[model samples]
Target: MDFRFSPSDDAFRRDARAWLDAHPPAEATPRQWERTLGADGWIGLGWGRTPYGNRTATLTQQVVWAEEYARTPHTPPRLGHIGENLLAPTLLAHGTAAQKDQFLPPIARGEAIWCQGYSEPGAGSDLAAIRTTATRTTATRTTATRTPSARTTSPRTPATYRVTGQKIWTSHAHEADWCFVLARTEAGSHRHHGLSLLLVPMDQPDGSVEVRPIRQLTGTSEFNEVFFDGARAHPDHVVGGEGNGWRVAMDLLAAERGVSTLAQQIGFGEELERVLEEARDTADPLLRDRLVRQWAELRTMRWNALRTLGGGPDPAAPSVAKLLWGGWHQRLGELAMAVRGVAATAGPYDWTESEPYELDAAQRLFLFSRADTIYGGSDEIQRTIIAERVLGLPREARGQ
Candidate 1:
């Protein structure tokens, strides 16, 4: 990969830089930034003119935009990052034209927030074990708190699948407008064979969907538990066809690790740089070595991530990236806290066990990064992927 910007791309970069200078993202609210970005056609750079202000942009432009945007301060928190990063790409590659037309524009405009409905109490690391069911039926009801009654036909209403299951550690579920859910659509079907990926509306009139915020150690509620009780998805909403959700889910995961990760790695680079700047005056030899080692590891991760991009997607690439960054971030968090000495362990006197804990930057990093290894995919799961897919190892037996 050349990694050089074309002259036209440079001009584009200049324009973007000038816009950022004028906007100074920190001063505006997230929604306000979204409107400005969407109006200017910067939100979905590679996707084109429908959402953002541009038409059929090149991949180079996307890269340039990501690079420049990260360089600028007050870049609005990625408000609809899930929709733009994972879902849009998946829809482009596998969704029907109608699905694309319906979903993509909203994502581009930061209007549609999305959540993933994959992990369940029984199926966190082993996603193939998800027990959520979507039974086709004519009857519509909310609340799947009980086992769905067997199909009884009614001629009056259009048929829809009743989604009944629970998804835990669902990021942004509480605020999402929609969710892409993987459920068993085939009765008595097992493992990867009987699955379907359903795009479900979170704001159903039946009140079948429930989102409860999961308080984190950081005292934030970004993660949630989502319950689906007789929530409905039109049969037409299945992506990549019904009974092929396993494949669709895998493709979405691959998309999860695509070029967008370049921007993430860049963000990681900034975090690592901050660590270096903060610890510069400290003379502790052990701390100094850890910082240098972290820098080297970050460089290696950046290289690996970049290489995967040029070579195209692999089943294990995202796992490798996740494993790399997840562990790296956790360790960096520890180092950050270590540098803060005793203050890392202390909080404000008023902040007791009953009150919501307030955290400083280093304290927050140390606490929150603990989940880095567990949330995306556990470190064990990523290793299993690398062992089986990349190395051609025999598959591990899943207990029946």
Candidate 2:
């Protein structure tokens, strides 16, 4: 495949860079960022057929936008755009006309936020074993949010099911307006059957939902534990039909492997650059070789990602990408500490003071990346997927 961008793409990139430089909302808070991006029509540029996104934008154009956007000095945070990037695409593919009309505009306008409710203490990547349930119940008057960004219309229908369960490691659950939840709709069902993807309201007026942020090693809480105690999902909110949820959820994961990845590489490049700058003053010869190797590996990972972008769901592709980046990031974290030498171990506060144990960026990166291999999917799980699916090896027996 040809590796260079075309002349037209170059021109488009220039235009994008100029506009971003002039407008300069990169430092805006998440809410402000969404409003600014939405007002400027930059929120969902390339998604096809939706009034919210510009379908005329080609794949190359999308990549160009992603690259430029990621490189800006202070690009706007994504805010609650799970509605735009992850959930919207899935909904565009499988949602009903009412669902699309109800959900898409608010997301396009950048007025709402969204979160995923997939992981639990019992199920993460092995999601078919999920025990969260949305049982059918009588039509009850319940407060409901249609999308993370918009309020539902006056009551025209009744609630269909009541959700009762717990979800752990839920990113931004505290701030999301809605959560796309995967739950077992049929009782006593096991593994990949009788599940439904329900659009649930995070801010139910009846106090049926609770969200508590999980503090990480970095001393920040971007993730949360969410509890749904008899929270109701309105009948129209059932996405992709009642029993086909596992398929819909899988489709969403496949969407996780797309052009957005190229943008992620840009951020990874920045982190590596910081590490290189710190390593510059180091007299140690060993750190130099590790830095050089990391640069080479990052370039290769970029190429691999480009080669596989837009390919069909190959089953092993997601696993391979996760393994590559997760391990690389964890290594990068280790290298950051090495560059700091002995100073890396010290925190910012005195033990006797009211507060203690603060970290700078490098320390935080080192601490957070420790879980890079664990979250999303573990290395062991990825290897299993590669062995069983990619290589056509015999499946491993349970309880081994």
Best of the candidates, lDDT: 2
Question: Each candidate's lDDT (Cα)?
Answer: 0.82, 0.84
Write the residue-wise lDDT of candidate 1 on 1-400 in tens digits: 6656689989988987898888787767766676667666666666655533334567667766777887787575576777887788788778998898888877776677888999999899889999999999865544334347764544456789899999999887877889999999999898888999999999999899999998888888878999999999997889999999999898888777666767776777887777788888999999999998999998888778767766754777889889989999999899987777887798776744676557877777788899999987899999999998899999988876
Could you tell me the TM-score of candidate 2? 0.91
TM-score of each: 0.89, 0.91
Badly placed stretches (over 4 Å) of model 2 are 53-55, 140-159, 310-313, 350-352
Evaluate residue 287 in candidate 1 and report its C-alpha lDDT on the 0 to 100 scale: 91
Q: Which ten residues in a row have the lowest lDDT in candidate 1?
A: 138-147
lDDT of 2 by residue, 11-38 (tens): 8899889888887874677887787777
Best by TM-score: 2
Question: Which lDDT value does model 1 have at 219?
Answer: 82
